[model samples]
Target: MYYNTNILKSTDGESICYYRWQANPDVPFKGIVQIAHGLGEHAGRYNHIAHLLQEEGYSVYANDHRAHGKTAEIKRLFGYYDGKEYFDDCIADMYALTNLMRAENPNSKFILFGHSMGSLLSRKYVIKYGKELDALILSGTASFIKVLGTIGLVTASTVKTFKGRERGNAFLKDFFFGEFNKKFKPNRTKLDWISTDEAQVDLFEKDPYRTEDFSLGVFLDIIKNSKKVNSPEAFKATPKELPILMFSGDKDPVGEMGKGVTRVAKQYEKYGISDFTFKLYKGGRHEMLNEINAEAVEQEIISWLNQRI
Candidate 1:
């Protein structure tokens, strides 16, 4: 069964869009997985993944962060230019939803599954609220801002201070999509998981839930919050015993700065954080979960969840 609802988060005055799926409500659930999607995408995109998990006896819940999808604010998506507000809002929204789920389905364990920027938020949340979950899975993860901290800070500040509300497209090209453009002949709309499915790309292009461009303020906020995750202080604050699984594609541009998903795992390991595992798909790209071999990626996630929970 699948259900959709709006969760009102009082802290930020944001009504987060939440989706729930369960195969058997009567049968005791193994646990619940709260999925946090990456930037520019909405929680609904993971319905297929949620269906698979529901079939495996785990209920699934997902929410669109403040700025993305149905939760967009007038000024900006999450926060105008300060990214920490977005992270804080995301954590609060997750906390509220988790408590709501616990109330709805008592006595069940809980896990967190976050992708891309969502993974970053998940990590920060775990550090602050590690006791809330049984395990965590981070996909297409990175510490980009950590690696390019100074540069990102300068760029974001310059963009926001000068450009204000005027939308800018150069940043996306220069930062996120540059490598892909270099490797392949740049196609403006060929942005969906490197697939030949024209229909998929077309749907994504027309999806009202998707955000093609971000504000300069939000861009800077991503960098600032990312830097927090990269610091030694952040690692030390993280609960060492919490089981974590992180993975990314070796060919992912996010890994270009040497701070990809594997790098994130190594950082935790360096801080004596055990019970963490990292994997890299040889030919995979940023959106591994949506890639050609998505089944393999999904299977890996299921297998890991089986061991941990």
Candidate 2:
């Protein structure tokens, strides 16, 4: 596949930045993979995966979620939201992008792949639109932690009440995400847990679009929506045959060191979702795509998708 960029207007009346890897013109596309990226990262970061998929004759697409990446850098949004239903806008962006891709390539089966925050959004996506897609893949995922989320919600509320919606707070960043790197003792950087690859970690740190201090409004939005998607009622509503694949590293705190990942799978099991697959990579970390053994992980993903498709 080859790479290119384009822009489309989202429902919020802002131009969305997106990237695509087109399948080889000489080869038939096996399917389409539309990625919903994690928080604090841009769609462009998946170029390596997209290139691999293109070689495999699969068209791949990814968009910068609102208030992040190039989308955030845009002058109109400037990495801020109105503190009202911002999470809903994030879901709607994926929905809009899906529709556009479907229209462009009607015959292709569209698969949803989400990581971290994107995985959370994908949980919400499957609840509402599971029947519309072929499969779902979640990486660096976990079931919600109500206690911590509650604390975050209170923090966001207090900050928003005092400083207003547009204000970014370092407290939320430290309180919620500060400990991720702590688990990796003598860590070179606060993000060593993301992947073992030092170069990738450095790249992520230097990336301009990688968010540092999140505003109170967006922080609360993550907690609020996470609670919504992690509900049993939400899991019960998803179609039984909607194939789901979730993988995380055993050391990933985001996945609660793999406990939360299993919980999510078991929740679906309770709901009678038959076609579910999960894995906890031994000695792995949060960002499996950028992990030291990412090639093996990618092959595993390919094998799973092949079986499902």
Candidate 3:
């Protein structure tokens, strides 16, 4: 399957770049998959997953959010997006791409798949836009502690005051993610928590786009939005009828080694979510889709989607 790189003008007048993998014309189209990639990564990295989905009759769309990947390169907004409501703006950008996807495939179901930071955004997205989605899949997701999030936000806010929002702050970055590497002792790389597959970790380390340090504003927005999504109100706002699937690696520090994912699932239950499921891949790290058993992980997603669609 071939993908076309396209551009969409965002609500704020920023050009959002995305890759669209069209489903097979011969087979009956099943659904549309919109992928929200993790922080510091581009939409093109998901091409392998897109190809698999395209073969399975699912058209895939993954966009580079503002200040990340191709969108950042094109706009020269490398670290931080303009404006205060960063989280809301990111969600809006995703929605814009989603609108385009739905327009092209009106008859198909819509599945939102988000990874890592994207997973956090997707959690918030379902709260506001759950009615529009047929299903939601969250990978490397966590149920962030409100108190910790508050502290992080406060620190980031303070730092943003001293250091410009667009400029990266090493202290803040280390304060949050520095411990991720510690979990993997004899750490060959700083991002060993990303995947056990050394090749994938190397690809990430070598990629200029992925290696760029995000600004303090990015951290602030993430914590702020994470707090919002995990709130009681956000839980109440989520459409109970929306089917949700949360998956993470047992060894993924982002999910607190699966504990945080379980907490999220429990929270969903507490909120009266009618349909919800979660899975933890044994010995898997943060990016299970890029893990050693990635093929199996991919199959799990395909099978789950097949059952639902």
Best by lDDT: 3
Q: Which residue segments of model 3 deviate by more than 4 Å?
A: 145-151
Model 1: which residue pairs collide?
A: 67-77, 81-217, 83-221
| Deviation in Å, model 1, residue 174 alpha carbon | 5.6
C-alpha lDDT values of all predictions: 0.73, 0.84, 0.85
- Candidate structures ordered by lDDT, highest first: 3, 2, 1
Residue pairs with colliding backbones in model 3 are none
TM-scores for all candidates: the values are: 0.86, 0.95, 0.95
| lDDT, candidate 1, 72-189, per-residue tens | 6434453223344557767888888888878877878889999888888898888888877789888877775444556767776776666663345466435754444354455656
The collision pairs in model 2 are 1-54
lDDT of 3 by residue, 65-107 (tens): 8788888888666776556777788888999998898888887
Off by over 4 Å in 1: 26-28, 73-84, 145-149, 162-174, 178-183, 186-203, 257-259
Better of 1 and 2 by lDDT: 2
